[model samples]
Target: MKSKTPFIIILLVLAVAIGGAWYLKKAATSQGHGAISNRTPASNTTPPPATAGVNGAEPPHTLGPTSAKVHLEEFGDFECPPCGLLHPILQQMQTEFSDRLQITFREFPLVPTHQHAMAAASAAEAAALQGKFWEMHDLLYEHQKDWHEVFDVRPIFEGYAKQIGLDVERYKRDVNSDPVADRIIQDGKRGHYLGVKGTPTVFLNGREVPFESLPADKLRVLINSELSGSK
Candidate 1:
């Protein structure tokens, strides 16, 4: 999957997704479709607000209190393979820290690289309209490969919506509506502004952490320390 991506797609995603070419290209280009500049990033110590933000994105799909000491923010593309790998881990974290941790998700669709990214984002947003965003999110990621490269995905999205108990008519209408499209675009733009360059870009307490560096157990330990004011 990584090798199949064209050079341009790698360049575009590099602005925010994890890729080798992205770091090299970032210093050279400042103007393009995925250019990110003057990013503030985030501090590791403090939790960012649930409202407006300067260091990073404050996506609306929060699962805990605005006042929670631990904030885990993920800027992910629905069809990105690495993001799919992180999905189950995130679910486990969400369950384990349901009371003390707040999770915020924002879309960062790699439209140039992933053909169905925008459509998948739209589908999730449509589910969101009916308070079923997380359901659709899980469905899409769980079955990512089934529709990853497929051009026509509306029917698949609609089927998932039905399985989740959403009104199929409304889901279909919302999926094609202006609001859903705009929301996905807005999410991606915000993610780009935060120096997001790939799927599964994560922020812990507003600071971006290396997912590879901190495995789930270590991350859980970090969270516990934060909650205990040990850090």
Candidate 2:
């Protein structure tokens, strides 16, 4: 009877320990779930602002000639691979529809992931001040891989200016100036107001165009239709 009693006490102790452990584990799991629930809900309700401009809706930052029939506004990140792919297409379009189509390039730098994007944008704006925007734009994309290696883009950008026949000293001074930085920042702010959530968002004739499946032929058709309608 004595031995049995000790064994029963031991069993009780073991049961108590198991119960305590299980309670702690359950409490910890509940806390974890509560923490997760406290986090912001994934936003599925609102489509990104950039996408709002589709079906002939205008974005906030409208450039180019107001009278032009077809307006092509492209929101792009400098470091974006898909933007790189679309760059050539934009160039071709610019060449093909030079007379009718007006293109407005807006900067949407994803700075958290794309370190060089903001600098590239600033550089382009600085070049714009010197009447060399398109030249610098082409150089940046053409040598994206090279400049992407360094976080501080001033040196490489200066090299590009030199290569493009821009005055290197003036380019450097302008790029570092506050006005150039302000222009890039304003573009970013405009992008935010326009609901640009990602890289490579485009608007054609005030309508949002899908980035992955941009229908060039359909776009041409739309422009032609607008042109005909205007006539």
Candidate 3:
């Protein structure tokens, strides 16, 4: 009676505001948590290593030498938040240790839990064919948030391939090729054999490292210990 129009309009505005806030919060949570799983399905494709070297997984993407004092084998998923967090720290460790450290990255994409995990791994593997795996790996982790929830990630991945100077057409083909898939599958088999059940699972000299020791300070101490023991 006394002009209920203003009251209804206010209610509508409040509902819209609330809905907007909810959406923003949901997006942030999804982006922050992303896809991190303790157990991932192993790939059924078990082809021979595309290239033989290192730990037997298609020459396996590695930094430093196989003869390095501290060998760190990491099983990681590209879409995983913890793996993303570990990326920079590992980079720092690589610089700090120089040749004393060898870092081997194995694919452990947690499908279903991470819708884009397989795709991301494929992108990295494709880049590997061009000898740009590390570049693509760094880019994917650095900009994880950018394409985390995008409707289509192929274009974004293409942009990354371009940024890393990869042959775009070849990259596209490799992304869907058996060789790339074989590499990932081989890594998965290794991970499974090693009893890995999570992303960022690291093994130092064939011994699994605790999650707490993954940080720089702790990992440095562990590396130093290993170095001393080897001497």
Candidate 4:
């Protein structure tokens, strides 16, 4: 309820130092869009229990069962190409097992390699505040090329917000708010603590999924196995 505008602006101003180098990197990688999926797969690690939301502060952008026996949680970077590739697969899983599944999306922006990762994460969080997180999430991946290389992605984010029917003013304000940044930072930190080393880290029933067995079909098998065990 309290205003966090002033703090967010100051933080962003400081982050500009990093963004400066990142922007240049973006320009250099302009022709490398299809060169995605270069991420190293995460190691097998114990799955930490996930909160219902990003940080247990704001509600998470979830699809399917609000509370179910099988839960799928993903810690993803919006700017990562592999994450983009896996996004629709997750969507398909949700559609197929809508009644029996619970899916939670958490932000994990890998800022070092992906220049616009943090910005995109914040934009999704802000859109979540406006009840359009899923829309903004999809659009970011759908049109990643449009804003991936540009220096000023805020404008592109604003355009997406507009198209998604979010209030531009509120979206701008919230995207620049400290809470959004906190959510992103905390989520990434949690991912690191949980041994999540890359984009598209998935957990099926609190177990980190091996990348080799992370396809939708395999995930369905995991879910069904859990269901069978629970029953």
Candidate 5:
């Protein structure tokens, strides 16, 4: 009977071990399930407010005639690829509808990713101070690849200023000054007020338009409609 008692004890130990292993496996599975339950897909919600002002209150800054019946406002970043693609379109529009259309250029430099965009914006503002905004604007877009590849913007931009006959010393100082930086910030804030969620957001007559999908012919139609309706 003592020998049988030892055998029973051995069996009992084996049973406990099996039970512990089973419990641990079950517990591990439960934890894995809990972890999976805790995870969730990100939500697509509106971003937080960053500034104050309404779309209409935003000031107009463009090369086109201020009194033109149709006003087109563009909030774009210098480094934005789409903005580069749209540059020629804007130029064509300006040439095609010189008298009736006014296009305003506003700074929306997304500096976090585009390292040189802010500096480019500053350079543009500096040129603007010297009444060469349009000249610099055209040159920047025309030579975006050169500036982006070289990683040296100041020299190239200064060259542009010199080409446009701007006061080179004043241009250099303005580009590095606080006022130019402030102007860029102010434009960004105004864009925020106008619900500008991304670069290349455009407004026509104070109304936001889906310009990415808007073909030139369709845009011309819309412009004509707005012009005729206003009259």
Candidate 6:
């Protein structure tokens, strides 16, 4: 026999290398493809009541009424693909539920991971100063693919501001203002306090909802559940 010992050793080494590769791949996959992976204890299970009302330094972008039975608070990163996907669904929900659903958007830009996220938040906040936040918000999501990867996004954002009837000159200044920066920081702090670890983390009726339940159909069911129970 040609020394079975050597063959056995080679097989063992190969097995270890294969196992290592598999583990690394699985780790990467768990980080999520679009949204940042959820690291909080809130995912897939109901958590404690979320902090109620506007907790940021500035008034958050809100749709519908405060008296609505179901309040949906979304902590989102503009450059996050999953957040972009959730945008339209939430808009539709707002239309369907009308005054019954209150939607509040909070900025939670993931820097480094998403290079343009902070800039996008700045654009929205700047637009808010012009009383056109919702318009800029919609444009950001609608044209996310256009600007997220550009070398510089200021021009694109300025274009959006102008399109929304803002004074582009003021928008340019406000985008870099202390107040704009402060608002983003404040929202991020609130997210951290709430144990949020990813983009598109949503709270429905002060309870964190699972990522799996974020789709239009599933979310509709959740909203309905909240509405019925509030009665």
Q: How many residue pairs collide in each prediction?
A: 6, 8, 1, 0, 0, 0
Return the TM-score for candidate 6, rounded to 2 decimals.
0.79
**Where's the lowest-lDDT run of ten residues in candidate 5?**
33-42
Q: Tell me the tens digit of each residue's lDDT in model 2 across 1-231.
A: 256888899999999999999998756533310111112221212334333423221232333465676677777888887787777877777677776777878878788789888888878877787777878887888788787878678788888888878878788788779887766676667666665677787655544554433546644555565455445
Candidate 2 lDDT (Cα, 0 to 1)? 0.66
Candidate 4, residues 1-231: lDDT per residue as tens digits?
Answer: 879998999999979978998997765433211111113222122334554333533466788867687777788988988888888888888888787888888898887899999999999999988889899999999888788889989999999999999999999899989989888877776676666778787776665666655677766666676666556
Clashing pairs in 4: none
For 1-231, candidate 3 gives per-residue lDDT tens digits of 599999999999999999999998666423311111122111122323322233446687999988897888789999999999999999999999999999989999998888899999999999999999999999999999998898799999999999999999999999999998888888988777666678988776666666766888877877777776667
The number of the candidate with the highest lDDT is 6
lDDT per residue, candidate 5, 57-91, as tens digits?
A: 23446757888878777888877877887788778
- The lDDT of each candidate is 0.73, 0.66, 0.81, 0.76, 0.72, 0.84
lDDT of 1 at 222: 58
> How does model 3 fare in lDDT?
0.81
Off by over 4 Å in 2: 1-66, 225-231
lDDT, residue 43, candidate 6: 33
**lDDT tens readout by residue for model 6, 1-231:** 587999899999999999999998766544322222234322334445666534765677899999999889899988999999999999999999999999989999998899999999999999998899899999999999999889999889998898899999999999999999999999988888777889898888777676877999888888877776677
What is the lDDT for 72 in model 1?
A: 78
Assess the local accuracy of residue 3 in candidate 5 as a C-alpha lDDT between 0 and 100. Answer: 68
Using TM-score as the yardstick, the better of models 2 and 5 is 5
Model 6 / residue 140 / CA error / Å: 0.4
State TM-scores per candidate: 0.73, 0.67, 0.76, 0.75, 0.72, 0.79
Query: How much does candidate 3 score in TM-score?
Result: 0.76
Tell me model 4's lDDT, rounded to 2 decimals.
Answer: 0.76
